[model samples]
Target chain A: MPAAATEAPTLDSLRRLTRAFRVEILRMIEAAGSGHPGGSLSAIDFLTVLYFRDYLNVDPKNPSDPNRDRFILSKGHCVPALYCVLAHKGFLPVEELRTLRKFGSRLQGHPDRRRLPLIEANTGSLGQGLSIALGLALSAKLDRAPWQVFCMTGDGEIQEGQIWEAAMAAPKFKLGNLTWIVDYNQVQQEGLTKDQMDLAPLKDKLAAFNWHTQEIDGHDLDAIDRALAAARKVTDRPKAIILRTIKGKGVSFMELQTAWHGKAPNKEQADKAVAEIEGGRR
Target chain B: MASATTGATRDAFGEKLAELGAAEPRLVVLDADLGGSTRTTAFMKKFPERRFELGIAEQNMIGAAAGLALGGKIPVATSFACFLTGRLETIRVCVAYNRTNVKLVGTHAGIGIGDDGPSQMALEDVAAMRALPGMTVLQPADRAETRQAVEWMVRHDGPVYLRLTRQNVPEIHEPGYRFEFGKLDPLWPKDPEAEPDLPSLAFAPPNGKPRRQAAILATGGVVSNALEAAKDLQSRGFLARVFNVHTLHPIDAEGVVRAARASQRLVTVEDHNLAGGLGSAVAEALAAAGQATPLVRLGLSDFAESGTTEELYAKYGLSASHIVEAALRNLA
Candidate 1:
């Protein structure tokens, strides 16, 4: 059985665990030969706090429990981080993380629910996860179920018009059971997100859309935990947490570097990054 | 002969869907600002709590429907065919790839939608939906067939794309008509059990002149036109058998091959683009079956102009006369 929030592990332990997960994220991506490492590293802390710290109501054994909270990685290119966290959460074997992106492996390059039934929906295509999350939240409301729906999207991914479409509908439907976390890393594949498409005043935009908005330093475990706790208290409208984060967060050489956005780290680079993440662990 | 009673397939869909909502509590409806036009207003009026008005955002609607399906609710997302399939990327990922139990209802299909013109008409929806693996594509010919297919869509698991007509299509199916998935319902001759005898493949019957025979495969609103075409062909002393092909993706291939063997030629008619709709499906079936039946595809060759349904059908070569001409063209 998973621990409740009251019996959750200390924030210090979560910090150490998340720092170690940075290595797992790199290891799998390095083994797979191609993945979006920058976004994965930027988003790992929130996923760890959500899964390991009892914010999400999923169990490894009863992953398909109807009443369990649904979490969807709408920015599915960053699934390496999700795979690592799911492994630690006992959803799958840790050894299977190495099989990610390989032919016939359950861990597809993106979140494919067909291949991994635990995934709430298939969501590699950008801007789609929020609407799907809206659907699940709507279903919960219709059934009067206690289940909640949470979706995570990259800062760059909100550029797709469908994101706004979902953003517009969730609030209109009064989907208080839903929460959307934006990993506002401010960087994308080609260049910085601002240079490509500016999402400045993102919190204001979401607030105007009627979402209960909050902005926090995404890498801080305490802030992530608190923001999620506060989001749960919101029962009249959808919650939007603009997680201001650094792309390629943990690795010094990769931080804020557009080159690390998609490329898999080489053997030397992977070793150096892993050493850096492990050294940062206190 | 076309029945005296005529009804829009969308009306049948909305009526059946609203009825299904009462019986199946798990059923939910989503509309992208086209509830009135798509006739989902009927379902929405009765089951307001169960209906979601997503407002002009088809991409979000498709994704939300997938999510609802994943959450164990049978979601029927309704929109104009052009607008609905316009968001194919979301449908490709959330619905098709995930195999979510979403019933996508695309109304206002083809030029039959009339003065709304090419923008509103779904000329490429069937092609887009058919290309996705495991996605069931259906285009019901009449009100009864639409009701039956709508019922089947809810009961069946996985994704289904139902193309419905905005214009009132003539009732071609009899009152006792039952919809069979992936099976062709022969409309002309009234009996499919008896093989349609028109002309021989090898030796002609020892009569005056061997009249050319054709098996007409038609889908959606054009089935009535094809039926009328068959009647006209009979009057002109040429025999043409018509098949109501409601199921477009997992089409009745064996039935198509059987028609190919029995008739001297095959003609497919639809209210969609000729490249990837009913024509392409029949062509693939015949090719795979190694049948040498010549086929003439009649559909929109280009984007249609704003006009009445009858004017567009007549001008765009989808009228009864056009179908009769297509069937007897090269055989003469």
Candidate 2:
């Protein structure tokens, strides 16, 4: 296992890693025959910065460490992004990423902790991650443990009422150790999140729920790093970082294309996507 | 004779949980705004730091309970049975599929939570919970059993769904009776010493002209009614034996087969829906064991109305007289 990055990687290096991961994400989905590629691509950059930038206190060797920082992908259909980051961190074999969504594979279609212990909780059904995250943060606060919980949710996923229920709770418990990152990729499985269900006034609603809020361009590695660092200093209230991202972030043909939200790229399209991602096309 | 001493199972759960909370530091309690009705206030009062009030949001409460369990805390999440199981998707993934050690306490089960009507009653909770893999479903019959079951639920490592009653239930077990998982609690012919050397199948007394015998399997809020039904049947020159089915998921299949062999017929009564409660479990057990024993199921066929507990029980065919009729069907 690689040692924890004592120093943050350069933004350029982080971008390079993100681009490589974007290609892996597309290839794995194409290999699986069925998966959500757009959201995975949109969330990969944030996940890359979060995992590689050393903002999360985790040990790949001891994935079950009680005090290790917890991460939950609430919008679980995009688990290809999480799997890519975890593989790179040595939590699981990088080669196993190809076996995703297959029979008897640890890389379940969704993040299943039972099959893979590195995942903090099983989440595929939407709007459940924040509550689980709040519970973890609340537990840590109860024990005065020096650990933080980070959860990532999609813009369309917050349509569930349970998200607000959890949003209301984290502030009530004063869970300052928890950080929620919303991958506001704007697009959803059906269409744009707004056309499906308007999450307009998203930041104001969250702020009214008493969360410390931050808004940033999700593709900016520096912005993600800064928001994570700011979340750590807040020891009295939970923090929510809203990452404005583009669905199908890197692949030009798939960018903002609702069809790319869940449909896997074909062999021809997969080859083109790899070329585009490698060529640094946005 | 069944003991006249009675107490609500939710109260027993609360008393036992508070005691367990004191003993187990890792134990945490979460409530969905029904702490008073579910009787978890006792736990909250004693262990203020350990108790979490998640308001009327049962889904979030369930998710948080799973999170706490993952964080190595024994979380007892409580709400009315209907509201708790209404979030079946969350439980299906977070608690059951995840195989997290979360204890789900669903009080006010079935029509027994009278006056609140069908909306508040969890008539299908057992069915929903039973469908989930690796979920332990328990519906203790009385105070003694509930206390023991609560203790066992905490000590056991896995997901558990404990269905409790809002109404008081008569004591069915004798003093010092132990609660074992996946086993039937024999209630009738109370004195074991008096029935020494009883035949393994088809017990008969001297000068008995093949006395008509039937076994009554009951669970949760209806076990006492079943005992009463048994007594009523015996007074009419028929022999009836009663067994309490506390664990509903990993049901006592062996005991069910034994009871089927020992009696001429079998009758199952529960406060839950007839489709997926004790009766369905017994029928499945009998079918799996290749027993063609005649069986009768007595429970709600539809949603119950708002009324007193006794009136609702009678209306829903869960009363003792109704149980006696069910057992007597096609048997003189």
lDDT of 1 by residue, B1-332 (tens): 54689999999999999999999999999988889988988888899999999998899999999899989999999999999998888888888998999999999999999997888889999999999989999999889889999999999998999999999988987778789999988888776555435336533434656667789999999999999999999787777889999999888899999888888889999989988989999999999998988999998879998999999999999999999999988776
The DockQ-based CAPRI class assigned to model 2 is high
Chain B vs. true chain B: TM-score per candidate: 0.96, 0.96
Candidate 1 TM-score for chain A: 0.97
lDDT of 1 by residue, A126-236 (tens): 888998999999999999999889999999999999999999999999999999999999899899999999998899999999999999999998899889888888999
Individual DockQ of the candidates? 0.89, 0.81
What local lDDT does model 1 show for residue B102? 96
For model 1, what fraction of the real interface contacts is kept? 0.89
TM-score of 1: 0.97
Best by DockQ: 1
Residue-wise lDDT of candidate 2 within A21-79, one digit each (tens)?
A: 99999999999999999999999989998888778888888887888889989999999
CA deviation > 4 Å runs, candidate 1: A1-6, B192-199, B202-208
